[model samples]
Target: MIRTGDEYRESLNDGRQIWINGERVDDPCNHPQFKPVIDIRARIYDMQHDPETQGAMTYEEQGERFAIGLRLPYEQQDWQDKRDAVDLVMNDIGGVVTRVGDETIGEMWSLWDGKDILNEIDPRFATNIERHIHQCIKDDPFHVSANTDPKGDRSKAPQDQDPDMLVHVVRETDAGIVIRGAKYETAAAYSNQAFLKPTIANWGNDKLSDYALGCIVHMNAPGVKHICRTGFAGRAPEADYPLSNRVDEIDTLMILDDVLVPWEDVLFYQHTRAASFIRTTLHRYSAFPFVQRTLSYADLIIGAALWNVKQTGLDKQQAVQEKLSELAIWREGINAFLTASVATAEKSPNGLLMPNQSLLMSSRVHALTNLPHMMHLARELCGGQICVTPDAATFAAPDTKPWMDKFYSINEEWVADDRRKLLGLARDLLNSDYAGHRLTFQLFAQSPPFAQLAAVYRNFDWQGPLEFSHKAAGLSDNVWGKGTRH
Candidate 1:
């Protein structure tokens, strides 16, 4: 069933232990730091019911509605529908906000695709994944991902280091398994649930290990404490750092202090092979929405840069036009990757449609590896005004008002207020502390740069290149014995 904004807000008042800036948040929906983000997420939930967006954001089956984003994609159209739903949410919100629900929900679908691997470990585990995927559709809950664990010493084994560094099963009881450790999760404090799993890939050939486990974790569960990073929202006026104060997806260092995970919620446990399999394919479907966010973000960058140049009449200059074109090129490159990945989408082993793995993987690498450069390019286009501009308060003060207006007003077309607002947006998007954190989030949120490239390495068909080069260079057939490239 589709939820309204109020319902989503009320859901957060479940007495979850959430701390930010040394204070526990009594009501996250009203807290200055979390309110803006929570409101945005609520609006997204409401969008599924709004007449204008209802068609795009949800699907009806037998008189019951479900969030399109949570639907398991079985065909190309299902994927396109999900893509359209994400675009609809972003457009309605007027800014890019990841981890609201859509992007992270696909992580569960990726696990669902590994049902066979899970079945080998435990049949019930496979069933659990399926049930949870359907539950998300039915409940329309806000879900986030939890992968990164604070590994105290990367060189030492989890057992050797502080055992609490990584989340693990400490003991099992009739009710559930008690787990200990922490995870760095975005939007965990405000969200309903998280698909918790291991971050470590190498399980040391051990068949059973406490670290090799996956489960669903309710944010308000006993012993689940959310110590969030200080949010950017409300730190500055929304008029100045618009995106920062409105759509910042707050990150949380979620401490699982001997939290109990019910047997029904456990997807997998003590099976290194299952953990290894999940690590390899965790982002197969999720990366599509995650990278799609970059596309929306690119639009924001391009729009800001282009509007800045237009206001100053720099659009007529050849050099300025060239830079604008460069931004467009990067923007469209991401667009093409997203479009083509779906166009050439492939079927998963579980018969679900997945964006073409090779194209999607390469696109993720392309989008992330060059984000800093793209942001820099846009920053250069915005010029020095974005950094040197005065705050809204300074622009409005009695003593400085006239001077600020005289300096900021560019022409009849660009008034002082409009110019100030534009610079504010550009600054927050490209120069603010929140901007830097956003860059870091894009780079490492999914995984480190090396791991992104590794995904490409694993998915890419090397045989085609090897075959072409081998044949082109007149290599003997005996040198590299092989059949035709698959």
Candidate 2:
């Protein structure tokens, strides 16, 4: 069933424990740090009912409406509709948000594509996956992902050191398995559920171990505790820090202290191969939406810089134009990869259409690897004025209003108020604490750089280059390894 904004808000009051800044949070819907982003999520829900946006935000099947983001992809049009829905939501909210439901739901689809592997362990596991995928469509609950574990020491194994460092099944009850560990999850505080799974690990030759697990975790379950990191919202003035105030998604150190996972919620367990398969293929479908967020961020940065250069009359300079061209080239490079991946979409093992892995992984690398450089270029284009500009209160003060107006006003068309607004946006986008968090989130949110490159290495067609070199060089058949990827 489709949920409205009020239903989504009311769902959060289901006796979930939340903590921020060392104080217990009674209600996230009204808390300062959580309210702004919560309202954005609620607005997204309300969009599905609005006359103007309901078309793009939802789809009808058998005369009933459901969220388009939760719809299973059977064709390319489904993907396009999902893309259009995400774009509409970001535009409606006026900023970028990464961890709402759509981006993480594809992770479950990835695991679903590995049903045969899961079936080999237990047919019930595969059936559980199938049931949950549809159940999400029926429930319309806000789902997030939980992957990274605290993993106390790299050199010591879970058996040797603190076993709780990595999430493991303590024992199996008649009801389910009891799990004890913690995961770093984004948006877990206010989210309804999380697709919990293991991080990359050295499974060696073991096929069955306690460390291998995947399940659906209810956010308000008995032993789940959300120890949230300090939020950027309400700590600073919104007038000077706009994006931080509105769009910062609060992350959490979600402590799963002897939590019980019922048999119905368990997707897979005690199977190293299943864990390895999921670790490899987890982001195959999800990266599309994740990379799309980068594209929107590119537009925000470019718009900020273009406005800044225009205000300073630097748009006329050839050198300034070259810098802007560089930003555009990087932005379009991301766009090209995203477009081409879908143009040559591949069918998954389970018959779901997935973006081309090679192009998608390459796009993620291109978007993230050069993000710091692109951010620096945009910072240069926005100029030093973003840093030196006075805050909103300083501009409003009677003692300084005249001098601020005289210096900041560029022409009859440009005034102090507009100039300061632009500077605030530019600073928040490129120079603020939120900017650093955003950059880090892109860098390692999905996985680290080496893992991303490994994905490209695994998916790229090495045989094409190998065969081409063998024919071009007229090498013997024995030299090329007979169509095998190197």
Candidate 3:
């Protein structure tokens, strides 16, 4: 059965051992730092049942209904349906950077593990994957995909790094395997049902026995610890900062100490090649959809920025209009790339349809580069008003209202109190820790951006383009070039 928003909320009471700062949290479902994410995810769950969104979020299969999440079969129609569903959810959220775990990364992890079934791995792995898919359909379990270890140095392998920095197999038993280490910069750890497949990359030959493993474990599994980052959203009084307060409330670090994974939860073990394949496929397929979602996110950001500009009476300024225009262009570019990818999607060898890898990669590249630029444009458009805006409390204060009313008002139409409200929101976007979190999210999402660009170059079929250009030149010989371009 598809879980409703309330059901989803109830499920979060599973007692996961999550820590923020120094103390362990008793109930993240109600905790200020984590509740907003839970609420956002609940709304996504409710969307599956919403009349207008039901068509896009739920589909029928084998005489049963399934949510258009991970359970949606990888087919042309299914892909479109999922795409529509993602856009609908993103649009409702007004493009704030919600944690990625609830749908995007969770579904991607499940799908990536499902790919292994195609390789004819042990029957147990395939069975586990199938069961996981059904569970996702029913509840759309919140999850965090942990692939990056806290590698102490850039020039080192997993084994070369301190063992504590890399999650690895500590012991193998007939029942399951034990692992210990940590995954850094994990988002939404406190609210997720499980952590899926730590580090999907292939461990080189020497490190295969240790690093090359994949599995899913309950968030509250024994010995699991969560450490969250202090962020802008969790600290502020909601009355003073309404919008930013509800977004980005669950970014965290996952620490695993001798965590045991049952045999059924293990997707791949000692199969370095398969691990590499899964990672590549997951990154190629999942990352692109996120890029597509960012189009809608960008739309919201642009709208909010423009709204703030208009509120501040700067909309008429030529300089501000130019920045808004650039923001619009960036959004349009993302939308165009998303449309192109969907239009040209192809089926995988396993008969599951996926976006065109090359085109999607290009989209991700653009998104990674342009997200920061979008934020910069927003900041520039806001100008000095972002900092000058008084807090909500100041507007509400008895003595300050009269003085604030005379000088701080932005336009004749809006009273000083009203203008302060709008400016407070603008301040939330431009001057608060919320703004810092946005920057951090964009950077982390596409961290080491050059590496992603390199991956795109490597994975993309350069021959097709090069051959076309060569043919255009009427050359009999094929020539290729090295290195990636911006």
Candidate 4:
């Protein structure tokens, strides 16, 4: 079920309504803002069929080939294979791009892990979740996630202010259920489908409500409008903003205006318990890929900073090397967490292998909470030249060519062109508008910092410390509360 690059490209022309910068996008594959990242996604698909990378990207199951990214994890090797495929794609594309497919597909697996909770509501709902998880492998469709709602007012309930503030079932028909609301989704405009669910956990004391719903939403469905934020690709020259031009994944405020979701597509509905279960465990598997992207980002910043220092001979200084060590320590901290989590992977309720929850959640917080400070460290290491660099055109112009060469050229090995290029990369990674957006995305993409801590709180074994302290203080077991986190 592996599709070629052309097939993936042609699939986006499914008459989906998409708008960017107050103008309609006719062909997302050709539109300037989307074309760059769309082409990157297409390249990833092509890598599956390419002779050089086909072995790494696709696996044969029952003599039928399927994408490795879409495969369900039953053993540890499955996770390793997925990790290798992501690394190969990032290396091939020369930058990091999340939400391509592998990252979002895991959200479905998370829901499948909660089949027991879903079965309590309706046995049919559990079956629907299972079928859709396998369908991703069978059809190889590009998937994304939709969880956050507009949520107009925090003080008022959704019913009080505007019912549409949260995505909910408006009416049920024989064919399907009609929904009205919007979700803030990244890459929804060009993606094939999204795993639509609720964002807020507190659904009052009601057992059933329209807001407690989940389903698979086709991106091109009628009444689904993709209103994307302005993209960074065409906003600047590639030489000055290479990462922004090539790897910016456009975020969209997807408007689901009375969209009809078929019966078979509904994973759960009218059950607040199901919504609560999903909201808590939504990123159980997807967090691996999400955090892995930040690992790649760390490499980007570290490499840029290290190269800048090397070009200027600051690498020989002990003081400069200390700052570089801090970056490496932070980078390796993430690497250690990811590596250990996979090594100690746990089996899910449905028997799928999940990264060690405590380590993975802690790693997510570690990667996100300190991302801004790490970026500042890299920026400081790179020094002031990253901001004052001349554009590529200015360097190439006859009037400035000789002066640029005389000043920028450090040594025979360190030419002016390479120095300028390195500075440009550093600027884009640390000092540009695109850099700020990327930092924010890392901070809140999966959930907010508090939510990440809550996941750690729920997963970590608190009893170990409580029991240890009790013994140390000669206190009785009754002092530490009963039923403490089995």
Q: Which one is best on TM-score? A: 2
Please give the lDDT score at residue 104 for candidate 2: 94
Q: Which candidate, 3 or 4, has the higher TM-score?
A: 4
The candidate that wins on lDDT is 2
> Which lDDT tens digits does candidate 4 get at residues 1-486?
788879999999999999999999999999999999999988988898899999999999898989999989988898889989988988889888998989988889999999999888889899998999888899988899995998998887778888888998999999999999999999999999999989784467989888999999999999999999999998889998999999999999999999999999999999998888888898899999899999999998899999989887899999999999989998999999999999999999999899999999999999888789989999999999999999998889999999999999988999899988999999999999899999988888999989999999999978788778778998766765663535
Q: What CA RMSD would you report for each candidate? A: 1.5, 0.9, 3.4, 1.2
| Model 3, residue 66: C-alpha shift (Å) | 2.8
lDDT, candidate 2, 270-317, per-residue tens: 999999999999999999999999999998989999999998789999
Task: Give the lowest summed-lDDT range of ten residues in model 1.
Answer: 477-486
TM-score of each: 0.97, 0.99, 0.88, 0.98
lDDT of 1 by residue, 54-150 (tens): 9988999999988888888888899899889888888888898889888888888888888888888889999999999888989999989886998
| Cα lDDT for residue 154, candidate 1 | 86
Superposed model 3: Cα runs more than 4 Å off: 62-64, 95-97, 100-123, 154-156, 185-188, 198-207, 311-314, 410-412, 472-486
What TM value does model 3 have? 0.88
Whichever of 1 and 3 has more TM-score, that candidate is 1
Computed on alpha carbons, the lDDT of every model, listed in order, comes to: 0.90, 0.93, 0.67, 0.91
Worst 10 residues of 3 by lDDT: 477-486
